[model samples]
Target chain A: MDEKDGCGQDGQSTPGVNIMASMEGRGPSCLNVDKDALAGHEKPGFKLCSYVDSFSETHAGRIPIVKSGLGKEDLFSTVYVRWGIRRHDYKVVPGLYGIGHPDRASEVLVTANFKLTFDHLRRALPHISAWILVLDTKGINVWCAAGKGTFSTRELVKRIEACSLEKIVDHKRVIVPQLGATGVSAADVKKQSGFRVVYGPIRAKDIPAFLKNNRTADKPMRQVTFTLYERFVLTPVELKNALKPAFIAALVLFVVSGVGPGGFSFSGAWERGLLAVLALVTGIFSGGFVTPVLLPYIPFREFAAKGIIAGSVFAILLMVAISSAINGMAGFGALFLFSMAISSFLAMNFTGTTPFTSPSGVEKEMKRFIPVQVVALAVSSGLWIYSAF
Target chain B: MKNLRYLDNVSTLVLDDEKCVGCSLCTEVCPHAVFEMAQNRALIVDLNACMECGACVTNCPSGAISVSPGVG
Candidate 1:
């Protein structure tokens, strides 16, 4: 299961943690490695950690992390090592990095100029000697860099010039990942730099094998796999983001209800309020996290709509139980309204992830669904107000 | 063959034949099959269908393609 598909590199957690926590059920979203603290190592030893080849901390940005002490120990091994949690952290300038002496004529691989992108690529190639010339895509992934134009021809040429690739590699050829096909020109590189660009497999792991098989990627290697593991990692970020608003709303519901004398009673309001908190959290989680994981098998592909349906069902069950158990005021009307509100929140966040969704699709969804959500919330609020009286 | 055109103002997804050296460089880099060779020349076949993913422009050997949007 290649881990590249987990919502790319967006970390969980948005902001206002305290407010969201008071409500219960906040959004999902962390970092870093101290060598002595790791499980496998103690004494002064090398740790497997990704270094961000380049990034800016001036704004909030992620540094891909790779822990220490994980590669093969054999002196002549050309194998890649795996250890700790391979985090997309560690920032540095995009270029060839030599943890040890890189034999000048070994292999020259191409990757995104982004610090995290470069970090991940190099970290995977641990224990191997190679020259990595990162294209300047201004901190973007390979697929996105191709789309955005930053990872296109000029930059590849520029990076090649900057790295002095011609001087470094004796062979007049460079191996590029297939994902960069959307931007790199093979023949043009050959003409200008006298280095024919050879596309390797879509993944870095396959690079060693691709080279072993004489610099060629099979068609299967060219295809991107959207596997289960890829989808699973993304679930956390979606859930993490939703947790904030969901919890805040629940807590406000709890604290506000307790303000009145009879409503705030420990035995009376406490249990009821707690139930509501649970319901809200469940609704949000169902919509954001659970719904997405079950996206393909969960009946619908329209992410937001699927999220809403899932959230709505969770909310209904929750509200119904609360109403029946506590003999509370939320009858059919309030239940309908509030359930829809939770559903809408989940639906809204689906856009943060999910491929195949275009800008137009998002606009259409917002147009049709946002109104319904606002109306439902308003109706729920009105019903709550009416019930209180 | 798809009739491709570059939206130069918006992105670096175009090919200037004047600078193009008749090398099949752009065609090789574009994963989406956006570029095609016509009479030993490179052309953008499906201009409207282009997602503006900067493949052709980046690998253009003659510095013919440019994805000029954000200031470098």
Candidate 2:
């Protein structure tokens, strides 16, 4: 349910007009709409809307007129999804959507149907009038969808024909996000469909300036950059993804640490097991969180190497802090190897998140370092068991 | 991007001059500014910077560009 921040405009008596419309497949995709919006209904003063003010009857049947201003519900859901919760299911129906009083000459912007991406696009179009053509990316964002081929030339052509785009817009151009260039071939789309695909700015926030400058994006708009805040925002999702695997590894370590010369001891498991868990947590934190934040500063082109550097530094510091508690030299060596291997592996996984890492580069790095990581893991496990006995 | 460079000399991207009709779509779509227009023909200006996103390969009408695309 959305807050009463102009969402209840025109004093509409219907309790959940917009929610009902989307539920019946008249509006854009909202897979998670029923869970929250349906629960909010039947309560007094509760207005549940999917940012749709009304549907405009157009050549493309019932194009939903989305509100340019994002409500509190929209903001809340965005934060929730950022932590990787319901991320796969968070999307809207792919179709034609209108904002403001768009005419035949208005520019048509193309984007994926991922709810967060859709929200960003709509929020950026406050005072502007435009038509949004949402492509079915299966809940994936523009960059990822494009890379995966869901936001392909095929899909673009299909959507244009299916929505009767030629009849709705007088112009021959449709502006697609620059990152979408990976999947969408402009020339192919122009050949297949009459609409000429114009590559827009990389970010949705630059839409106003891009339109003002005659639909041509400058160098900065076309290029991708990973700033501090951008790197920071991605860490939470990385940590969240590492959570389950880290827990399982910790459980395995605890059980393995219980094996000794005399018998399996719960006291030894509680002691050495906790030490192993600590080492694993240190590895995850260093690789997943620290490595990403300090990516540019890390002294290696390979992400695995960068992660090893980060993990080694943290492991040394941790070892020094708990040197008195450590059983012996073997224990210290085991912790160092264990943390470095885990960190390096996690850091290698981060290549997919970065914009500039080529698949070939990643494959090369993986082949070079995976063997080392495997050996380190094996050696560390042996040392930990030997130290336990 | 200059500071955040990836692995050196690893990209499989190659441009075929004979196939090129030179529409300049590659220059427009490449996020790394890898392509440049010279005498109505697109040339690779910074090959190392190229992340092999295949924006050029797919968008190139003449089949001038080719790269086996995949996320790193």
Candidate 3:
């Protein structure tokens, strides 16, 4: 979709303009184009459509309307969309949207423009009809966007005024996700737009219970938990992002491993290079996969430290298993250093994805571990090259 | 915040109790429950629990709170 299509900066949609026109020719009926087909579904109360009808448009802009609950189509599309996002299919047009049959009296829930976040919010509120005020967070999730200031008081006020929200909703309150509180000032929002900001539950799933309990969130609902399942689900994207750098490092190791006293030769080079590659891969598994899965069980409070320990253990096991492949003590030392460095670096990258890490903690970790990792890698590379000669 | 705690003495959160009006907005907005209402003013009950997300600082109408963003 063109960036300006759904809601113009001035809060207006060019009437009758089909925003889904671009998406129409792309695929089959999975697009859910026909309004009649959407409304005629087996799901009686819910409805889905790609384009916003004239009835839902306001002076501010048009709001895309969709079914309240998650259907088979929504789940299927979500999986594919999440995969696409890893490949950088970002830029979902930002604006207000309607979930179920929302009216002015319905609760107004605020969220970021990231499509995955939007989908999660809408899907969570299956039975309740609500107005979702999506801020232009540059397609970032609420937490990170709030930290970046994209989901700030200024953007909230601008979007509210632009959407002419006062005219549509009878209430002056807007429910904001708890994670966005860092960026949104309730007092400032009240002063600027006369709308009171109510902080909601930390997780979308808790919204139903929260709303049912008269918008009062319990301690559990307010808290953010990073369970094993949550950590596991995030590993795929982390692994995908790390692939290019890992490949480059492996390639460098392969070439460097080929150098020997007699100069580069295919026979000895392949054996050494293959061993180096195996060690590197083992490090990646320990750092990227094992550390995250065993985060709570890991002995160290620092992620890098945990990674180093895990990598060292793996390196020791590998060395013991393939002692015959080693040329000298230098080979074992190089392998140990190489694995530890790789694991430490990869585990540090996970700090951003984890809930336990704070920005201050991350900064401290980077300062303490980055130099150590650099020295370790440098020493390991030197040893590998020296051993070859 | 309830069952989990990261490194201690790392959060860059600062609260000026003299300027605080005890609105409890910080307590309400903080996902980690870093603040508590004591007497008429908000107190930093669990300073180490803070993730330094700046939610309390932003919501404080009296400019009583300050946290260096991106410092964790």
Candidate 4:
């Protein structure tokens, strides 16, 4: 029997078998199927198959039956992406992928090529059979990719044509993540490709609930919230980025602190340099880690203001802990200003990561506070150098 | 967007109702639900919720919506 029209024991079309047959070039309407293929094996509810072809130089066109659970490589890639190692380049090739055992009637969900995004979408629906249409966003997450226009109408149309989604799926609907809405114009997608775009929930975890409710997203699912947990999770990468600059600044301070009135003294320099380094580290933590976690509770909407408050608290504690080591008022003032400036700058940088801050708001805040921070840092550095002499 | 309002009165999003053809494209593209349709015209329901991603403006075929890109 032709697998496309084949039915299961319940008299329903065998979606799993049909999809597998199509992949293996056994389906009546199969296209782009390579001659080099492996044998297919059947399980209780689904079948497994593989094929290899060269569609494009970049993609070797090795289509493997996508399994439900993640493999060891997926786990390692998730961790690496979280740690921001090769994060921008970590992506799966964008194309049509069968998640469970989707047939023509099954839902087609769109996502970015960013591996984390693809993994999250697949993991969310372990039981349900579906089709995942990944767009080429150059390994960026949905929200950022949408903003950059990579997860766009043009790419979506291009991918749809390349994957021949029109021929595979019986439906003319594509469900896109709510975050990708910024880049994809549903009307334009409809105009360009004959498919209707249905925006799904803001979070991948809500996909089950969304589909359960007849693909209708509730207000909560549509709403985007950046809670403490959300902010805390993003801090790892922020902290990592801050460490490089923090180390370089500390090294410079160590050498500069050694230039005393009677020439360089290693012992005296080590003590002062250690104190300065501690202050810098404290500043980085306050701005990069503390500010984000306590964002909602922070007094002001402006990130720099929040950082200033956080930085002041840390600086005060440091001063009280090392009051006896201070040689003069200049040293104390310099340390305080330096800590505050560093914290404020780092906090301001976080505006880019947050969902709340707008491009205009960031610009306004930067225009108002960056000059002040620059002046403070310059004065602090001059004071520190003068105190060393 | 409840309990997640950003800065007050700072959004650069501007909607020209006169030019709006009431296609409702802005309502569909905004992730934050910043726009709503009333009487077949788009209205900025929650201006503070706008992150200025420019989705609405970009998708607005009638040239009714415009926002300063970097002002968000």
Candidate 5:
């Protein structure tokens, strides 16, 4: 054990738990793999978070013990991840973990290895002592990982055996997050691993209540809600994803607008390009931000239709405010069409982000709306260029 | 999620009540609140709200629920 490692804040560290398994002065030891082999396989300079302050010696092996409190680094990483920075690399070492001096009889809670999900789970278990069995979902959140098939019954069963959970826990029951139910068949898991799967609440925050209520979640805990705050937080990633393409599209429009009867008027390009860029940015916010925030209040079920309405309203307001700057009716028409088409397309793409949209529903809408979006884009491009002359 | 409703009649979720064992796993696993217990048997109360995530189908011990699971 590393002498520098300190136990939890409470000083109630399990007697048999080791501080850390020394590995050539490396700060933290990876319980799943040896340091040499893990270094060769992992991306260069990439290291799992140093949340394991100590280790619990289990019948399976030495398992990392994570504290319930999150440090500054953990909070900062969560913010960075929310903004879509280094998203794919944000994961923890998937294996068994001890929250608060969990023993053989402590409840075993299964979850994905995405660092954010792991953080949330550990953060909620401050007073509760439990053995967390994290499944490797490749940095994806529980719901998305479940839908994508990474957090499947096979993985759960394999992980159970690999961690020697049968020896670690006295009870033959494991609690999986309800969202993971999409991929994990409880019946199959029970049949394969001799462990009964009891699905926990949809959100980590509700876990304490769930456990208190005899491991049964009420209707509120089971349901997934997309609130205004939830929708607001999700918009940054949407904006970041669309920003690059929107920038390129704006640049092309600005350059093409320079072509006139006077042979590339710099003044004309500057004026018209500003208008085109504003329209594009407005479209992005209207569809990517506004539509999502007002998703429930929006009139239509089809995101494209809702986007068109929102974009048109914003475009009309902007044009009316700057009518004197526009050349003619064609200029106004071009800007309106550009904003509408961009917003509609972006909104349609948001189907992938929503929890309630089905693949069949998205496919149905795409088939009906994609051709319309293409036509609008083509006509708007033609009108935008023609009005320049 | 309660106020927000998607396109009507689009989900492919189907429940075979005859095969249901009244285990209530379907109701517990459904995140959209699509399933409801009626006379101790699970029923699809809100088919339109179903996103076809297949949580109910996977958790149903009796194999009464079936849905073509797919991500949007």
Candidate 6:
């Protein structure tokens, strides 16, 4: 442990239990490689790296915890969509293991096997020692896993038998995330595992308080708080994921204008580079960052639609400025094509995160909008070619 | 909207009434208000509006619900 490392507000590595190993295979130490800016303050020793800047988060509250048999750095982390429709596939593993030396009487808290879910749960309860029974939800978060049948009664019962949870903990009560209430039947879990399922807070921060107050979730604890901080922390990964496709498409458009013969020319290709980058970066911020911040208030309802609307507005503004300074319809063509690409890409990606979008809905959007986007690109390219000629 | 006629009317959710224990977890998690409880059982009041997050089908106690997508 680094002496200067910031251990959150409570000076503990996690809220309720000692973080043994994360699902991303992190050991005792964490290094935030692609950590987002939203992570409040970094404790020097905290290691972080993600397929998408997975770390760089800080807790505003506290909970109790103890390290499992797994060390700190070797623990697992990172979220991956392995199968289809963005199903989670990473986790801290399930089963009974030695966390804080096999405390015989420790409370049992169950969570999804998702690495991020495991990390937040461990981080929030850093002060308490307990048994964290990870349910195999294919690396999904507790709430999501619960709704996915991965944390259902049958699985819970099987896991209990497999891990012999009754043999380890003296308590007959198992704390489960309220969000997981979707997938779990408290009574059914009780009938199968002999442990009373107590629903915990929606956010991990309130875990310590809930446990201290006789393990009960208050009305507020049951409420899902999608606060600004929560949404902000997710931006880095989405933005980074979007960067590659944006640049490649922009370069192609610019090169076509510069190197094409007759209807296409390279004379203005260099000038369009900075302009393309500006449109792309602006579109990204509008859809990836700004729209999410204003999600609830954005017009036209659906998350993807809202993002597109935002991107369109920004694109219009960009075109207005370009048209005034450069005086050409090529700028408008580029503006339309770029905005369509950026917005559509961002909107399609919403399938990974939003709670309301269905697989069917996403599929429908792709079928309808993809053709429009392709035609838009074709038209824009044609326009550029004609102007060059 | 072009090739798909049921895009606005089809739901991927299926309820195995035999497995359902009448828990309202599905109703609470669905933001679009696709389900409602009736006679200690969940009824899809607005099947066309379901987002298909699998919250209900996955969370059912008796394993009552099954979901598949169709343009319908």
Task: State TM-scores per candidate.
Answer: 0.60, 0.89, 0.85, 0.84, 0.87, 0.67
Cα lDDT tens digits, model 3, A1-389, are: 23333322212322212222223342223233444434424366754444332235544555667544333434556676544444244435676777657887788999998767876786577567788889999888899899899999999999998888987788999999999998998999999999999999999989889888998888878777888888887887777777889899888877888888888877667889889998898889889988888788877778899899888988898899888988888888998899888888888888888866778888888899999999999899889878776
lDDT string for model 4 (B1-72, tens) is 465556778888999999999987677667788888999999999998888887787678877988885634
lDDT of 1 by residue, A1-389 (tens): 12222212211332211112212332121112222224443338654332322221211122222221122121012111111112233234666544223454677778886544554565456455666676766766777677666766667777777766666656777777877766666766666667777877777767767777887665456444445565666666566566567667876766643444344544534654565566567666776667656666655534556766787777767766666564445434655556656755685566545432334445556667778778877776566434433
Worst 10 residues of 4 chain B by lDDT: B1-10
For lDDT, candidate 2 versus 6, the one ahead is 2
Mind sharing the TM-score for model 6?
A: 0.67
Candidate 6, residues A320-347, lDDT tens digits: the string is 7767544367756766666756765675
In candidate 3, which residue pairs get closer than 3 Å at backbone N, Cα or C atoms, i.e. clash?
A: A11-A60, A359-B72, A360-B71, A360-B72
The 10-residue segment of model 2 chain B with minimum total lDDT is: B63-72
Error of 6 at B33 (Å): 7.9
What candidate 5 gets wrong by more than 4 Å, as runs, is: A1-48, A262-267, B69-72
* DockQ of all predictions against the true structure, Cα-based: 0.15, 0.70, 0.64, 0.59, 0.70, 0.22
Q: Whole-model Cα lDDT per candidate?
A: 0.55, 0.85, 0.78, 0.77, 0.83, 0.61
Query: lDDT tens digits, residues A1-389, model 5?
Result: 23233422212443222222232243453333234434433567866445764567777877777856564467679899888999889998888988877998889999999999998898787678899999999999999999889999999999999999999989999999999999999999999999999989999989989888999888899999888998888888998999899889988878877877898988878888899898899899898988888888888899898888888998898899888888878888988988988888888878888888887788788888889888988888788878877
Off by over 4 Å in 2: A5-49, B69-72
List runs of model 1 lying over 4 Å from the truth: A1-89, A98-104, A113-128, A135-140, A145-154, A181-196, A243-276, A320-344, B1-72
The DockQ score of candidate 5 comes to 0.70
**What docking grade applies to model 3?**
medium
| lDDT agreement of model 3 with the native | 0.78
lDDT of 2 by residue, A1-389 (tens): 23332334412543332333343564343434433434423468854456765556777666767767565578779898989999899988898988877879999999999999999898787767999999999999999999889999999999999999988888899999999998998878988998888899998889999999999888888889998889988988999999999889989999988988868989888988988898999999999999999999999899999999999999998899888878788899999999999899999999989989999999899999999999999999999889876
What lDDT tens digits, residue by residue, belong to model 4 across residues A1-389? 33223322212332232234344454332222322223342248742332211112113232344544343356667787777888879888788777655666889889998888877776677567777888999999999999889999999999988887887778899999888878888879999999998888889889989999999887778767888888888988998888788889989989877878888888757988887887898789889999888877778888998899999999899989998998898899889999988899989999988887788778888999999899988998888878876
Question: Model 4 reproduces what portion of true contacts?
Answer: 0.58
